[model samples]
Target: MMVKVDRLSYNFGPHWVLKDISFSLDKGEFLFLTGHSGAGKTTLLRLLYGALPVNRGRAQVAGYELNKLKKRQIPQLRRKVGVVFQDFKILPRRTVFDNVAMALEVRGMPRPHLERRVRAIVRAMGLETKSYSICERLSGGEQQRVAIARSMVANPELILADEPTGNLDFDLTMHLMDIFKQFHTYGTSVIMATHSREVLDCVPEARILHLQDGRIVTDSEPGLEEDVQ
Candidate 1:
């Protein structure tokens, strides 16, 4: 399994955001987290990506036990897990290529290697020409692509995205979903949290887990194997 959560729980002050959530995701599996606003979907994604400290229970990703992730090792662990947030987080003054290359640069990747890899991913994301464009000048969908490119440039083992398509139009939303499906085809586990049914319909084969009241109310269906490719 790429990710495993055993009786996970989290709280903000006195309010519990997650309640004993336990689940597992297999290698290359594409899963969807669906829930209403204020649901614990975002919190769960944060936990999986190591953005939020695990307050209780056991969690592991790509073999790194969450509880044992030392403060010094968090950065290294994050390099193996890609994350795309709802609000596109791009360096306003940086060009698209630099924003993506920054991921490799921080990890000590050679400048030559960083250029090759970053350009390859930028082209793969259909932003070849925009590589030199400033992030603030790009359109919403284009900016989102830059964010996705930055997340996937490292070719991480797992990709966790929260409402990645929130700023995209219907056509662009399907385009991004197709890209994610292609990534899953290549054996990268993907977990996306969103409330958009239209995007979910684009890939009905994905396993959808519904959350409510800080609990996983509905688990993956037994017959979903046929629908999920």
Candidate 2:
């Protein structure tokens, strides 16, 4: 399994944010986590990426036991997982190339190799012309593309995207989603948190995991119903 969660629950201070969440994702599978705001979609994604600890139940991602993952092992785990946040998270002072090359640079990748990889991903994202442009000067859609390119430049085995298309228009959202689909087709497991009906409609064959009050109420595929407690 690429991801596994059993009887998982999380709390912030005294408030329970997730309750007995359980599910599993396989390699190359695309999963859509759907729920209203505060339904714990972000929390769940964080847990998978090791941004938060797992204390209540078992949670495994990319073969690492999240509950037992050590601090030193986090960087290794992160190198294999890409995350796209709702807030672009690109450094305003950095150029598009720099933002995307940061991850490779941290890995000590040589300049020639790093540049090639970054340029490839930038071109793939349709931001070839903006490779040297400052990130802050780009439009919302362009910034979002830069963010996606940054997340994907290192070729992570799994991707966790939180409302990646929330700020994009119809055409841009579809375009970005198609890029994600290409990644999925290449065998990367993807878990995206989205509330957009259009996004759901676009990937009808993808697994749908619906959360309500932090609990998974449904785990089904398109045209098929499965009740998950």
Best by TM-score: 2
Model 2: weakest 10-residue lDDT segment is 220-229
Q: What lDDT does model 1 reach? A: 0.86
Task: Name the lDDT value of residue 191 in candidate 1.
Answer: 91
Output candidate 2 Cα RMSD.
Answer: 2.2
Best candidate, lDDT: 2
lDDT of 2 by residue, 1-229 (tens): 8999999999999989999999999999999998878899999998888888999999999989998999999998999999998754899989999999998998899999999999999988889999899999999889988888989988899999998998789987888889899999899999999988788777777998989888988888955744322
What's the distance in Å from true for residue 84, model 1? 0.3
What RMSD, rounded to one decimal, does every model reach? 2.9, 2.2
Candidate 2, pairs of clashing residues: none
